[model samples]
Target: MVSQLDNPNLNLIPKPSHTVKGLIHIFTTAHRNFFTDVMAQALRIAGQGTPVLVVQFLKGGIRQGYKNPTQLSQKLDWIRCDLPRCIDTPHLDDSETASLRDLWEYTQKVVTEDRYSLVVLDELSLAINFGLIPEIEVLEFLAKRPPHIDVIFTGSETPKSILDMADQITEIRRSHTP
Candidate 1:
């Protein structure tokens, strides 16, 4: 009456012994699947009250097709909050700006209050392109996060500065010209 879970031949990846205090991981396409798997595991741990935050840097038009691997959408009950994407830009009128500001303020309040077990920032680099904040500034913000918080940064072509700050670096490279 033995089960697969009790099989001695199985090799189970070790989980974090205790809740993660602080961790920073940088990964590229060559290691995308491994990185994704690790993130999924961390999210599972975070769901058990580890205080997790995920900041994904997707190229413009990329994230629209992606789905949350951890089922965080259901776990966090996240609602989309649109920002101005710029201040006084010709495209957005004062009314639009005001609305965007209000949305931004509301979202920040929810995040700071820990309303969700996880917060997903999809395609944040696209917003960075709008000059909302410098890439390094975001990294600094992440580094200064409270020890109880578990922050995950995911992107394709991450800035070198941010990558340097990461504790774990996984580079997934594919040969393009062979």
Candidate 2:
């Protein structure tokens, strides 16, 4: 799907292929359907046998409204920063967050080792915003990532540097009813 950002002159569209290289996707939206968006897009590509690594920086399980996609594909890997919990009890903690270095390490390993073709950095912007991670280091990783890897970023308050590096950018706005 192709969408326009606030900049009318620019359009954001995700086009991927095994041969595609150095692609970046930034998904910025207040709408709650982004998981579906992420899942649909990632699954299709991963289903094609391209490895996809998903990292969720949020401090909780999948949001209530989002359907967490299964790791049905052998090529898909999901690494979450939140602690696991049963549905009946939500483990609330202030210190469960993954450190900036840890996230950076995972990203670096994926990129430097060429373990994945697509990477989804979910809520990474929030981490950067809260100073949970160093923005410069993340930017450096993105800049140095192998040309064959494609990256997708999802969250509110995306950093401008990220937006500047994006090969495509999409923004979804919430609808209100009176």
TM-scores vs. true structure, each candidate = 0.47, 0.72
- List, residue by residue over 70-175, the lDDT tens digit for candidate 1: 2353343322323323232325556544543444345345555655444445434344555544666566566555544444454455666776776776655666
lDDT of 2 by residue, 72-168 (tens): 5888877664345312222324544433345457668767898888888888887788776779978998988888888999988888998999999
Which 10 consecutive positions of candidate 2 have the poorest summed lDDT? 83-92
At residue 22, what lDDT does model 1 achieve? Answer: 55
Residue 86 shift from truth in candidate 2, angstroms: 13
Q: How accurate is candidate 1 locally (lDDT)?
A: 0.47
Cα-based lDDT for every prediction: 0.47, 0.71
